[model samples]
Target: MPDAYSNIHLIVRWLHVIAGITWIGHLYFFNFVNVPLQGSLDDATKKAVNPQLMPRALWWFRWGAMITLLAGLTLFVLTYFYTPGAGFGATSLLMDADGITDRAMWILFGMLLGIIMWFNVWFVIWPIQKKLLTGKVPADQVPAARKKALLASRINTFLSGPMLFGMLAPAHYGTMSFGALLLALGLGVLAIWFSIKSSSRVGKPA
Candidate 1:
């Protein structure tokens, strides 16, 4: 039974990693490459290029996000709640059921961040992008709509690094301190900020 559960975990982890890569790859492409490219194009060029490009990319992006989320939740259930042959695993609490372990706290933090990112992708960014793609947004509201999506996407990006820390810290480092998780999150957001600033300088006079 343990072997079976292990196999399931391994397979789902693979799926989660693959889907996460696809989702985050598209996200970075849009942020670092497409945004600048869009600014350089005239309206006619945008009309010709955007329609042809956005839908295909977004299809994979959104679906990847969905798969990653589902896989991640499955893993959480398997790891923290039900353990084959071990009955109630983490929930068994070993010593304390009501107490939150450091590892659990970190994993929960990451899960929260990932869930929020998923919500933003599906509910906020996708809707706004759909409106833009379909020419459904009023001209006066287009910029605001675009801004809203961009902001949500940026927030996700900022959260990604810290989320990784939250997810990985427990597994690798074990018993991560709360302060350490907070520091990792802070650094993660700072890394995103630096990347954005540095990107603004590329392909320009040095």
Candidate 2:
């Protein structure tokens, strides 16, 4: 049987995978389906849909993000704290030391992406969505909230590609270069900042 820590880590990883599926799956649905549907829906349908369905979906979406982050952090801690000879800062090779030399860079990228995703869900998506859900913002204001939500969601999607790429890359390709890591880091940060700008509402209606 696995030790207590190992068992805990395994559970966390399982939960992470489950939560990530829910979160990213809904994210894709929102971007690819919901946004387009909004354009096609009549105002009455939109008003009905946004208040009822959208809020519940957003609740699941945000909570899934929270659980994913928690599970990821738990897994990271388990790896860093208990795993023998494992250096959190230095190189990491959990299984295939010979094949997966890029493990460190991949881990770093995944961690960064997780942070950005968590922030987007909690700080950006949830807040604006709450305003729309409550009566704080009128139906007229939903457009602005939606614009903000969509951009943030799309930003999450954009980061998702590279983040998943980096996460799984080590298993396929060798370690990435310092230049490549820096490029990924820069791109991730830019994606996050640009997303914030897209959703900014200082002077906007909602």
RMSD after CA superposition, every candidate:
2.5, 7.9
**TM-score of candidate 2 against the unseen true structure:** 0.73
Per residue, candidate 2 scores C-alpha lDDT tens digits across 32-103 of: 566655666897887777888887898889999899888877776665444544434322454445644466
Compared with the true structure, all predictions reach lDDT values of 0.84, 0.72
Q: Which regions of candidate 1 are displaced past 4 Å?
A: 86-98, 203-206
Tens-place lDDT digits, model 1, residues 32-150: 77787787789999988889999999999899999999999887887778867767656542225558767777788888988999999999999999989989999999999999999
Off by over 4 Å in 2: 84-101, 138-142, 170-174, 178-206
**Which whole-number lDDT from 0 to 100 does residue 15 have in model 1?**
92
In Å, residue 32's CA in model 2 sits off its true spot by: 1.0
